[model samples]
Target: MERVHSDRSEQLYQLYKPLLFSLAYRMLGSVSDAEDIVQEAFLSWSERRPETVLNEKAYLCKMVTNRCVDRLRSPGKQREVYVGPWLPEPLITEALDSDSPSGAYLQKESLSTAYLLLLQQLSWVERAVFILREVLQYEYDEIAEIVDKSSSNCRQIFHRAKRSVSGLSGMADTVPLKSESLKALIEQFIHAVASGNTGQLMNLLKADVSMHSDGGGKVTAAVRPILGADRVIAFLMGIASKAPADMSFRIQMVNGNPGIVSYIGEQPSSVITFRMENDRIAEIYIVVNPDKLKHLPQR
Candidate 1:
């Protein structure tokens, strides 16, 4: 009987781990912290009396959600004092595309850096409520139960959060180009940068394109967002000119979009992901913080 119970617990963990991790990652915006919360939730679940739990999935989700809220609400979290413009730790496509029963809830747009940063603008509770309703398609009652709020209150919070992020959400609604097309554009971008073809690069970027680099004060990076196509091209060229002779670029799926990863002799030096508007790169997110890149699959 003890062995059987252990097997059952293992099955339950396997069934819900992905869903719980998705919820926690969206709420906390840190891959490592999200993973820690999910692990802690399962540990707590294992200690609970089986008979007392009515719905396993809901109970597990509630556990993960509340823990994420607590982590976000904790005083002096790193984001408050993060060096330069902060970007969420990149979640590579393989991890994002892992097989899971609740995979439908993990919408591609919701996982983008732009969307995650917009989520940061909301209050912790509001972020939880919005993600539950908007991304996960939870009913109001379900969200209320997870959040420990009244159904009506959850509805109100969702609406308020929706209004706050409506602009970016509207942009997200645009139909994305086919994957092949995006890859071709990325290839063109690489060639343009590598060959010092400013005119070609200018045509690939939007007039108002902006680039953000997050180094976490551990490496050299721009302290402020670089704006406009001309400035962005100049910055890219400047980096290209100074980059080591051994540096190489590879295309990888980053946050559900094709992106570039730069390597300096097998060590990942940077990960770059782009946000597109009308087939042009509108926003570029480059994460160079070594601490953040530790989780990336080694070359």
Candidate 2:
């Protein structure tokens, strides 16, 4: 019956949809693109008989991954002249419980803005191999099938990708800063800026700290990275000094990490996430691009 077939199709879609979305999201930093790819995959699945799928999970994953690869290779040139420093779209994963194994893995490995930026350095196949084998722990043979490469070639690609991102890969295994610790840090940071306490702000930042903000040319923002603690602190203080009287900041999960979200009235002005080293903040990434923030709830 038509009803029976439709019900079965919906059931199968529900079962594997989350994992497929997660895979696509990691492959492409855009949540909107990932959702679109997942929807396309589901449409394809609906055309096939559910009974024919012996391994629905792997089948769905391959569909999404291949789509992401094609998307990456597509002739999209928007990022070429992007305003200011380019940054990944911040993904809020606060609903996921970090205590679970899957939650812990995603938070540490693929969801960080820094890790996503590093992934951009890899070729499409290399990125797929690295994510599938290293992050997801897929067997080489399985990854080969998904990527259409021989298992031996997949191994070589994985090693190559590993060497290319070795320095940036370590953060994937370490724990994110504790929520309370991050909240305290942001509070201290906000207070220092509000009080014009340069010394306090400088102490919180590493000497080699770098600040990058992406405003997508639609709003006012720095056109290049601000390096060194002194310059970065001055930049923050300058922004704070000119901030609107009604502006406020709140802690929110951005890209599976704690970050400060600034708002003016009901509109989000900026999202700032950090990369810490040796208990001090080493890097700051702020996204004020209106296009990227459209997915975020205004409140």
Candidate 3:
């Protein structure tokens, strides 16, 4: 009987791991931390008497959500003193196939650096409630159960979070460029950067384009955001001018969008992701933090 129960628990964990990881990742904005929370949740679930739980999914989700909330509320000074702009660790999403639905694209957008940064603006509980209600479409009562709040209170929190991140609410309504077109643009942008074609670079960027670089104080990076197309172009050109002879850039799927990863030899030096608006690059996120790049494949 004990062995049978163990087999059942493992099956449940496999079934819910993706959903739990998604919940924890959205809540905390850190892949490593989210993964840790999911593992811990699984361990806790295994120790409990199976018959005592009414719903396995909800029970697992509640454990993951509450752990994420607790982690966010904890006093963490790492982000407080983080060097330069802070960016979420780059998430390499699965390539979209021809049969992929539009909803899959939108889901990938939510994982973008820009969207994740917007989520960081909310308070711990607000972030939890908002992701549950908005992204996951959980009912207020279900969310309340997950967060240990009343249904009405969860509703209010969700509304407040929605208001705070209203800029991103239109994400679902806006149709993104097809994957092929996006990849073409990324390739063109990369070529322009490599060849020092300032004119081409300027044409690709929006008037108010902004670039953020995160090196975590361990490497050279911009300490503040570079705003406007001209400034952004200049910064890019400067970096290009100083790039080592062996450094190379490869385009890859980053956070569900086409992005460039710079390699110095076999090690990844930086991951660059763009946010486009009206067919122009609106925001650029460059993550060079070694700690964040550990998950990426070498070579």
Candidate 4:
């Protein structure tokens, strides 16, 4: 009986791992933290005697939720320990890359780092409630169970969180510029930067453009977000002009859009990805701080 129960518990965990990770990632906006929480949740389950368990999925989910809530309540340790500019850890095309795993379709908007940062604005419980209801389509009852709250309470939290996130949710669906289009746009962007063509760059930006970077304190990057087309263009050119000639870069598809691969003497220095919203680019994410890029796979 014990062995059979153990097998069942393991099977249940396997079934829920991806879903739990997705929820955690959405809540924390950090891949590493999400992974850690998922692992810890499973560990919590493993330590449990399978025979004593009931509703394995619910139990595991509560563990994951509890772990995330703990992190949310006390994030100083995580934030204080972080080095440099902390970007949401990037996942390769293999991880969140496929919109459907069996179908192997690339998720156009999944790569947008913009959505993750926006998620940061909500409280811990609010983030969990919103993701569970909005992103995953979990009903209020299910969410209430996971968070140890009443369904009515979950609804209220969801409402407030939805309002907070609605404006930014449009950013979640940003389509990455395709090869030819992105190549042209990147050329234009880079050329504009090289020539200080703020006009040309501004023309390429959408109404509410925002740019962010993760130099992680190791490299020099904007400590704050750059907003608006004109301001973003100015910032881009400044970075371009300062880049060492030998600090050459190559263009690659990152987060499903045309991105720059910064190199120093053939070693990868950083990856800069753009989040596009039609004719104008919306967000620019530069991940130059090396430590954070360690988990990023070769694209």
Candidate whose lDDT is highest = 1
Q: Give the range where candidate 2 is weakest over 10 consecutive residues by summed lDDT.
A: 100-109
Best candidate, TM-score: 1
Q: Report the Cα lDDT for candidate 3.
A: 0.84
RMSD of candidate 2 to the truth, in angstroms, is 2.5
Taking the tens digit of each residue's C-alpha lDDT, what string does model 4 give over 211-240? 888877687778878888777876777777
Better of 3 and 4 by TM-score: 3
Ranking by TM-score: 1, 3, 2, 4
**Model 4: lDDT to the true structure:** 0.72
Q: Report lDDT per candidate.
A: 0.86, 0.82, 0.84, 0.72
TM-score for all models, in order of appearance: 0.93, 0.90, 0.91, 0.78
Q: Model 2, range 1-299, lDDT digits (tens) per residue?
A: 66777887798777766666667777788878888999999899878877878877678878898899888767772467666788887887776787754365556546778888898888888988998887778899888888888999999999999988877655555556776787789789889988999999988999989999998889888999999999998899899989999898888877777888888988888888988776678889988988878887786
Q: Model 1: per-residue lDDT, tens digit, 225-272?
A: 999999999999999899899899989877766888889988898999
The candidates, ranked best first by lDDT, are 1, 3, 2, 4
Flag clash pairs in model 4: 84-216, 84-217, 85-216, 85-217
> Pairing residues by index, what is the TM-score of model 2?
0.90
Question: Can you tell me which runs of candidate 3 are displaced by over 4 Å?
Answer: 95-107, 167-175
